[model samples]
Target: MRGRKELEKYWGRPYTDTRDWSIYNERLVRRGEFYLSLDFIDHWTDLVSRMNTGKPGRPFHYPEPFITWMAFIHVFLQMPYRQMEGFTRKLSIFIPSLVSADYTTLFRRIKRLDISLRVDPTILSRNVIIAVDSTGIKVTNRGEWMREKWRVRRGWIKVHAMIDIETNQILGLEVTDESVQDDARCIPLLDQVQQHCGREHTIRRLLADGAYDRNEIFNTLEKRGILSGIKTRTDAATRSTGSPYRAECVRERVRLGGYREWAQDIDYGMRWKAEGVFSSGKRIFGETVRATSKEGMIREVKMKMNCYNMLLTMVK
Candidate 1:
């Protein structure tokens, strides 16, 4: 097919030696059992001082830093709560904060927890190029037979996220039930990106798949002066009633050579970096949620993304 041929040609590119970066990233994790332990201690201790966890009766044994950092350890190691309690106790020599909270207290906080694992935007470059995408996250571990034979609907959550394509850093995330469409969240995801990165930070472009081929998405990008690399649906016209940018995109193809040519010109293939977000998140956090309730599932999946983004910061 012509499409297949075009893709093959487009795939060709030069490679650079990124081994040094990989070695450095590994060193970040390799320094201790708690990878980036001191970084976390410094980060969480600062966070705790500002938090309104409030004065507990008779001064609580746990420092907010200890409880919070240990929970992150829970996610990073995928350790069981009880096991992590013991693990933290043993590792307190490195970060004294780890001993402040026991695993039991940590578990209770985790179950009833509301925390945002945000990347510090102040540390980033002002240049922003965002990409948005959504992926299905399984809510249960049950197999296909359970759904097919029993006519049971499988529980699933959808994770919609926007990321900085250049740095592979996630900027914002939204978790929803399976029924929610991808396009439905594009605007909100952009809002989230702006909130996280700050309104003053300029977004240059947004890349997405055909699922984001909506007039609203195009219009929003146009108003913000952001170039859009969203895939147009096969049957969708270049002149849609709602999208003015569609006209520019059509012109882009004609001015260059063809559809694939324009895509290559703009480096639109970088959209897959958004896909990489889903792949890495699932690989690190997991493919399924262990929570039984909808709220719990949403929180777990959202936190998974948050922690995943935090890991991205470590590589910096």
Candidate 2:
């Protein structure tokens, strides 16, 4: 065993970080440009014309894209609406044709905005594996002060998401109150994955931690013909508790000696991509929701995720 270890060490090459720091740094710098982007202004008139063509109420003075850009700037830069309004008014000083939305307009338009994930077209042509997980974003950032002064409990909302392991793009997202369980979201997330990937694509597998270990989850995946790489509970039994597939999974893990061996066989390490995504999202967007209302908070989270996906594409 000692000789084998020495031979393995001699033959194996330790992986090195070969990333191009300059290009990566450049991409990060470009993120700032999105916050201040004026390219949308070129098509501003046409967008408004189409938007106002047959509308019932008063025609929109500011285009939806411009409103969306303001919203994006707000979330990405963590700037308040009033500050965003000031920023836009400042921009209009240089570009005489620019029309700025005030804080109230910004707030109303952002809440009413319909945000959706912009998935890559290539995902439709290939079989995919997905990792599923959820994380909590604070409902309000006043937790410390509120707790100290008012003795009130500050709550959080859950952001449940599924990502393509190959592309590291979010396939589906569901925003719920923190009371929603991880296992309960699996099927809905799977449905959303299908919606984004379309009828032609196949989900080859799913990877998740033991938080998703449940008979219903296993059976749902089994029916869809997708391999489940969800880690079973430590004391999982081979005996069927309702789902034979779950029993079989437990048996397979037992046969492989332990979780580590099973993980190797299934390449379960890829599940960390979900966690990495959550970390990246939190780092970029912060852990708190800026909106106080439930509806506004939901829209805010969705918009941030949409921006997150856009940022991912930019880096690629």
Q: Which candidate leads the pack in lDDT?
A: 2
lDDT of each: 0.74, 0.85
User: What total of clashing residue pairs does each candidate reach?
Assistant: 0, 0
Taking all chains together, the TM-score of candidate 2 against the true structure is: 0.88
After the best TM-score superposition of candidate 2, give how far the Cα of residue 31 lies from its true spot, in angstroms.
2.4
Give per-residue lDDT, candidate 2, residue 64. Answer: 83
Per-residue error for 174 in candidate 2, Å, reads 1.1
Candidate 1 on 49-97: residue-level lDDT in tens?
A: 5553585555444455555566677776678877877776777877665
Error of 1 at 103 (Å): 4.2
Q: Which sections of candidate 2 miss by over 4 Å?
A: 1-23, 123-125, 143-150
CA RMSD of all predictions: 4.0, 4.4
Writing each residue's lDDT as its tens digit, candidate 2 over 71-166 gives 778888899988988998998999988997788988888778888777774644478889999999987777587678988776789999998877
**In model 1, what are the clashing residue pairs, if there are any?**
none
**Candidate 1, 116: how far from true, in Å?**
2.9
